[model samples]
Target chain A: MANERMLMKGNEALAEAAVRAGCKCYFGYPITPQTEIAAYMSKRMPKCGGVFLQAESEIAAINMVYGAAATGVRAMTSSSSPGISLKSEGISYAAGCDLPCVVVNVQRGGPGLGGIQPAQSDYYLATKAGGHGDFYIPVYAPCSVQEMADYAVKAFDMADKFRTPVMILSDGLLGQMMEPVVFPEITDNEPEKDWACTGHGNKRRHNIINSLYLKPEELEESNRERFKKYEIEKAELPEVETYLTEDAEIVVTGYGASARIVRSAVNAARAEGIKAGMIRPITLWPFPEKAYAETVETAKAYLVVELSMGQMVDDVRLATSCKRPVRFFGRTGGVIHTPAEILAQIKLIAKEELK
Target chain B: MKRITVIAGHYGSGKSTFAANYAIDMAARGEAVTVVDMDTVNPYYRTADLGDIFEKNGVKLAAPRYAGTNLDVPILDFDIPGLYAEGRNLVIDLGGDDAGAYPLGKFRQFIGLHKNECDILYVVNFCRFLTHNAEEAEEILREIERACGLSATGIVNNSNLGFETDSEIIGSGRLKAEKISALTGLPIFCHTLPDIPSCEGIDREGYYPLTVYIKNVWN
Candidate 1:
């Protein structure tokens, strides 16, 4: 079916996609570069017979998502860096209770409330451990505004399919850039939430949603069960986009905005007759280990470019099993690296290592 | 007699893109153009980002104090009144909708002083919601006029779906713009279309071929 394309900002497109993906409830607090998501939802949700709540805090927003998702409703909450930090506790709680919800972290520069520019500094916070527990949420890193819209639907589906919290890990660049997007046709194939804590009406046993299991053995059982699901996810998910990686000497790797810049740099290097390739992780959590390993046979070295201080570089090293030398190039505190800067790094790598 | 154009519209309605293009065009035509970024609501994708292009084209850019500084401070720091007194052709890029237009009241006195010389242009994109129809468009324009204490003298039909814009989209946008023009008794200032081959069948009256300066990464 031909869908009418429209020019939309990244945040607006993501919000509209979530609504079309059967997201009935949206809870968010306004933050820079991502407030358009809440603004779009406020105008859209009510008109579509849904709920849009501007919660008092990020904590309240994610907890509202948790509560709403417990009723078998597709619920979502979005925030930037510091706000996402505030939401970590609630996210962990939802994960502990095995609830399916979508959390969008349109990240900004951060260790604290850093700056309001695009940054992928939260790779660890998102892919490694969002909160204190040993839980992993499937993280999607979209490089384009169209991908931003596409992943919103996929994030919700993955959350429901796995019965676990899922995250769309975007940065300020993807959250703010305007581009043309056509939404996917939504099929109403919602998974049956038989474990939802809706009132049983005496026809079935009342289901209770709780994260606190006082018994250590029960907690261990829950943790072990979640890890088993992670293993299945690692096999079924882990999407990666490879560009000209066959018989290339240098493989540049990054995700989100960095990947977009790296793609351009790879093209520039190719134009100069350098065997430069790229591997972009669409799914950041499973880390696309197999894709990286596949390129290891042909790749001489790896260049990991990011907007942070070498967070994803470690993953690339581990994915390749440290066979190839993985070097990182990055800029922090809200500064974006240009394609020329990345191209310079690639040229240097070719001159030093490729020789 | 300086021509002061203030571009106001709904959010994501191509205000910054139009303002940048207009300023660049005026400067290229040997007008002393000064483009002021009065957008305080949105932090990204403002006219200020085109400062380099403006500089190269001999257009003065009056960006906010906090722009490109990595500071998360929302401060209105443009000297619109001072820029107005320079007698240069002034093109002000406002924020989106009523909330974004509220900051325009800071230079309400300059707009009031040069009421005859000032041309407040309401950029309309039928592709956007809330202002998708004539009635809704008029409602938003009224809200913007109230918020800025300045009435729009002309309407710019800048309806586009980014890269997917075609003649059909342009025709639909024109129909909506005509309705808005009829409802508000405002003249159609111009229709903004990209310099694409598909725009051949569209009406050429008051047609301004737009050079899309604001772009995403992949474009």
Candidate 2:
């Protein structure tokens, strides 16, 4: 038996989920659309004997998260679009060192000083390697508050499980939206701190955490090992929800908030005699490329829609390998896609799809 | 186009303040000059506080977009597209020590592709470490040269008496310039002028040279 329903905002659920995931260290600053996360952590962390630091800046906050994660403690940070750009360097370092830290981006409009409103413009920065050099970060996108809570817990486990940095690729709407969520119970058994920097208390030797493999061959070997981890990750990580695809000829795909919009369009498209289905990605990084390809094999066409102007579509297209007609419709810089608008495109694509 | 002259010094030195005021003096001279505070290490006295003043002087400012400046956060990507492509000079005020400036390593790949149009200057205070002696100065020059994968062609000798200037900005500066000259064989481009020059401080670095037009100069 489990507690089935509780009202929660997406941001609030993420914060609570991190706690349930055994994350006791939270370092973050207050920013739009995701402020609720920091606020919730501030209140809950204190009572739970956890560490919560409201850092002076987004840069400092991310570093604080880095420092805690370095100690092998479950640590996290949350910010919006502009703030995410500031944290890219740290995120890159985290990947370079293979540290487990959870970073959440309630994306907003961008390029520079993008608005505080909701947008998925950070798709490129998150899914693709945003930082310099070559290392892959596991990115998770949660379209609903329920997934936000579940992913929050899973993000920490995945990070610890894979020894990699994981990002919750969210948007302001998902972050701010309120919905009924049933969170998992806090577990008694925490992961072992075999690799963390927490002092061994006169153990065998001192622990040094660094990404500097000075020797060319040594660094290259380390990079190769990281890629090996990524290869295994790709096999195990696939998150998606499909609807009404038994004989659908066209598919509408999206994630985070846009996925919600695509769901509505999917329902309407079906009513209009358009054989349209919906595909929402739950994990953005270990991107469910297999599911995408499998769905596309029988479908006549695919329609990709997002708030950002065709960023994720690139990944979608690459996954599908141009097997079917893959089209895109998107808005950049703080514009949300509407269900009717997406259905109209779905209708247009289904016309060809039906033929 | 805006102009900026980076003023660098050792840890606990006043170079950042000097760079900040230099931008201020340029603005007073009716020149729009913004101080691009690239100091990633230091927490206080950054060029960020002068954003409004520089803006008023037509001197636009740019710094890491941190809410606070002291944290050791990774430097953000500057998205002012074409700043490096400018035909005018832009000042890149840096933090103390070479390691403080190590972040430019990532951008070196991009900068190298555009080296045909940009200028990079190393600011030195003779009394500081590494630049305090000719041998040390040579080592410092070598580090910046190698780190950026570009030699420091221009030098700014901001030799100061540590808030106790002799009312004359000459002896200390001249010695440092000579050392830089003898060491790198690069020209001592300019030293701090008691009276700052005229130039709006905006535009990204490499656009134009940040110059302090000193009268009665001796070098």
Q: For each candidate, what's the DockQ? A: 0.51, 0.01
How far out, in Å, is residue B156 in model 2? Answer: 69
Could you estimate the TM-score for every candidate?
0.93, 0.61
The residue-by-residue lDDT of candidate 1 on B1-219, one tens digit each, is 248999999998989889988999998889899999888888788888889999999999998777866673667765777887788889989999898899888779878987888889999998774566789889989999999888899999999877778888888899999999999999998989876555656666668878887654532
Score candidate 2 by lDDT: 0.71
Model 1 CAPRI rating: medium
lDDT for model 1, please: 0.89
| DockQ agreement of candidate 1 with the native complex | 0.51
Q: Model 1: residues >4 Å from true position, as ranges?
A: B28-33, B78-83, B105-114, B129-139, B163-172, B195-205, B215-219
DockQ top scorer: 1
Q: A1-355 in candidate 2: lDDT tens per residue? A: 1563544557878898898888989988877768778877886899899998999998898888878888988899999888888888888888888889999998877778756667888888997865878987888899887889998888888898898889999987787654556787766445786878888789658777788887999999999999999999998987788878666688788888888878778888778777788778888887888777888767898888888888878778888887888899987776666788888898787666666
Error of 1 at B50 (Å): 2.9
